[model samples]
Target: MGTFASHRLKNIRTLSNQVSLNGYKEPSQSHPCEKDRISELPDDLIHHILTFLSTREAARTSAQSHWSVNKWTFLECIKLDIDWFHLDREKFCNFVDKLLLSRDNVNSPIDTFQLSSHAIDRASTWLDLAIKLNVKVLKFSEDRRWEPFYLDPNLVVFSSQYLKTLDLSNAVLDAIIFDQLNNACPALENLMLSDCLMEVQQISSSSMKNLNLIGCSFIKDLSICSPNLVSLRIKDQRMGNSSSKNSYLVFGTITLIDASNVEIMELSAIDSMFTFVEQDGSSPMFRNLRSFRLGPWCIDDNFLPLRRFLQHSPMLEMLFLKLSVTTSEPPSTDGETRQERSSTAIGWLRSEASRPLITLWPREKPLPPPPSEATIAAATA
Candidate 1:
């Protein structure tokens, strides 16, 4: 592997030299000092060149000759693509375990490591290695469904101290994952969790500035205390079987307490949760929120809270409601009260229909000219 990496690096250098020769605008003359100058470059400069290639490629270069051998060990970024090596699960696991144990003994500080694997055990080991290396950015993913029980969320937390960005998909996380994470990764700034099982619990953080939750199912109780969150996105898992409403289940209320500094919020669910309406005297959850998107088909009487919540966003610049409205089992209140409430809502929308729509184009664009008086009279005639 080391020899191959060295050869590839030398090839790259040759190609670069050829390009430089072709592109140089000045007349060149060979000087005896030129070779000495090239050889005088610090070892750090050669190691930087090796770091640009894959770990395998870099190692291959090390074996090209003695000069390249020690240079590969100074790599700042160790990126490994196991697929290119044609190794099975057992071989891959052993390879990573050896590399990590050997590298840690030398106290190597790996800035970045990307491992794509089908073996969960290998991934777990790599995670441990990353934590030991004090990796700055770690990306982990699997193409095969490895047993989930063998994976530990603690390892992820361990990586969080030095980790700045994390992208995890199609994995199972123990419920206590958040507890470990909150304690370990106080510096995490960007987070993406898609199709992962998270143990439902309180998720309080001031460090996360951007969050995306996509295609996740088991959200029992989600609470956010991050006041500095700038972008927030939550999307429901798509259903493919039936078009009917029988599959829908209204779960639990999702509360947001301290996320008032959000600027962009996109929320969509297959079921309705009482969306808190920010009122005149009420405390707003998202005070700086400018864009709000809600799945239209998910709204029902349960969504009245959300409508009421809208009044709180005085600075709201955009409102998108994709309603597939359905009727829910009404409360025990008399029909008269329900009718009155419905009427009031209709009247409010009617009155505000002519006003500048936050969801529409320009805030100053006049609403579609109200039905022409002549057209109304003609319909009556």
Candidate 2:
């Protein structure tokens, strides 16, 4: 023990002598404590110094640091991608548990909390904790193709009073989500759902302002009742498929039960327009509607849907028609090519000075002929 102590002293003395020979000043008594003491400084001061550190250098601090306070806690934005666990449920839960538990005392509210959909059962627990922490924007992403995680009904009952945006991908949701949001998340205004499936057919939300749906399917006929909704956009994710249908989106009925106030609406699907109707079969006046975008399906259906909208939405201002190079499944059998059919839709839109101005764009590279001079004015006549 004495020999070992002597060796350590000799090495220190040699280092000191080398510093002296190099004209370097010897470190003071506080020099040894400066490294750890810097971390004890004000958070803002320490954060500024930390900004100069490279990501690799910063990562070193995470080593053996899980138990350390003020590390992963106090985060304003928390995004947990569970793929790192490789489906190890125990580790995933443990990681999320520790991360959220550490934030129990954080004063700042979480701005966004994102979790991957692959986090199977315990997702509810993590989500509940995030909502309890006053998460403002909650999002979930798809990890497994088309696999959905249930938004626990119990969790939804007390989700968030401050949530403003709910963005979900590859999630299995139902009308319960919308029905329950009114009381628990009164502030939610924008709802974006993609690659998801609805177990039920009806969704009713009174407060949504903007709704976006992409590549979504429903088990039965679909109905939406959002009286306060302003902007509604539904896009067909499967655009170029030869089949007349989108496998990701299967619905027989699409009814806007109470969207009379919607101003800007865009529908891109195989049959969304033709199937669109009010539940009462009466034309509910979209008195505030200003802009409407339609896809190729309207022309394939002989402009029946277009006619319905033009007649019902008296205040409709601008119309947009997006045509794919090829028509989707159950090819139009009226002996009229899609190009010919579109000219009729466009010709009527062009001839009418009182009707909404129609803007046309093909999904393909080639452009079609100019609007036919032989106008099918019957559409808007």
Candidate 3:
């Protein structure tokens, strides 16, 4: 009788504690942190949250719970990073095909679609979808190992009239491909191409306002005839050079015509020769250029080209130069320092500053300005 009573008492105490703990609510679990998490969010709120994540991560969220599982397919802006070429190609192709077909009922067009290509066949398929969806921003980054290869012709011809920004980096392309792209993309405004190889015979475009070509090689001559090119950046180690000695001897020229609206131009090239000559007998001018950055290899003698460019740019204001004393051609004296090279560059700028509407820096250091005077007056005089 005593043993039976002891067992009953222990069982009742255990049951009472289990009931009390289940009834009690923790402060954190009920409030904002866990409360605002995916399950608790409304459909619209969840859609906004998922937009920031890549398509892969957004798809994985479906495993979290029932609510998340049903909604992952509704993502509008999908960014597919197809870097793993080791995977079965057929599997990847089928997966992409299904994902695109699944979104046929979407209410809004895709805003951004970024892809990294290891397989051209897969990339072309994705690009076809972007055209169908009217994707606004399309970016393609090719794998580094695959080089001196051809691009899919469909990609060059595909047009997304609403495309506002285009970035093609680390790809081996040709001028013919670019010609097709420029013709297709009429509304494109911003373009960036870095570490790209193109035997670019000509660059023809319009409606492009900002252009950045970093670490890109040009073959014989580079021409920029776009009237709307407002800002241009050309920088990276040794741009537009061919390895062949005979090829190197052939002088390559860069032509900028009717670039009057450009406000900023940044250029950096090393172990390469360049000259910016305004087109002969042309009324074209740079009316709005305010800042200029030259290559580190630029010498005092290099300023000859800018004399005409400065005459056209009446509102020029700031200058940044990368000048070095050491060159393939040695300095006249051992005492020549980097500081002296900078001084030489500044002197050339000072000569250009004499223009009625431009400012130039003569000294090596930044100077304190009068507090009451306008910066334009200080910059000009």
What's the lDDT for all of these models? 0.56, 0.65, 0.59
The deviation in Å at residue 305 for candidate 3 is 2.6
**Candidate 3 lDDT over residue span 1-381, tens digit each:** 346445533433332333221123223223354332445557765565555555665654543334533365566677665543244466456656666766655644677778766645557667667766777887887665555234566554557588888787666566766785577789888889866766666666788899988666666677776778878877653323423111222235666656777877765544345554466776547778777666544444444445555577676666556554344444535555545666665676666535443223322333223122265457556
CA lDDT, candidate 2, residue 169: 79
Off by over 4 Å in 2: 1-34, 43-67, 83-90, 105-108, 117-119, 154-158, 239-248, 271-284, 327-333, 363-381
- Residue 163 local lDDT, model 1: 72
Writing each residue's lDDT as its tens digit, candidate 1 over 203-310 gives: 666688888775554547666667678887775555443222212132455666666778667666545353532335656666686666655322345346546556
- Tally clashing residue pairs in candidate 3: 0
What local lDDT score does residue 79 receive in model 1, on the 0 to 100 scale?
63
Off by over 4 Å in 3: 1-49, 63-70, 83-94, 104-108, 237-251, 271-284, 296-302, 327-342, 351-381
lDDT of 3: 0.59
Give the range where candidate 1 is weakest over 10 consecutive residues by summed lDDT.
Answer: 360-369
TM-score of each: 0.67, 0.73, 0.68
What are the C-alpha RMSDs, in order, of all predicted structures?
11.7, 11.9, 12.6
Residue-pair clashes per prediction, in order, are: 18, 3, 0
- Residue-level lDDT of model 2, residues 241-304, one tens digit each, is 4332324456556777777889888776655543555545555557788777777877757878
Q: Is candidate 1 or candidate 3 better by TM-score?
A: 3
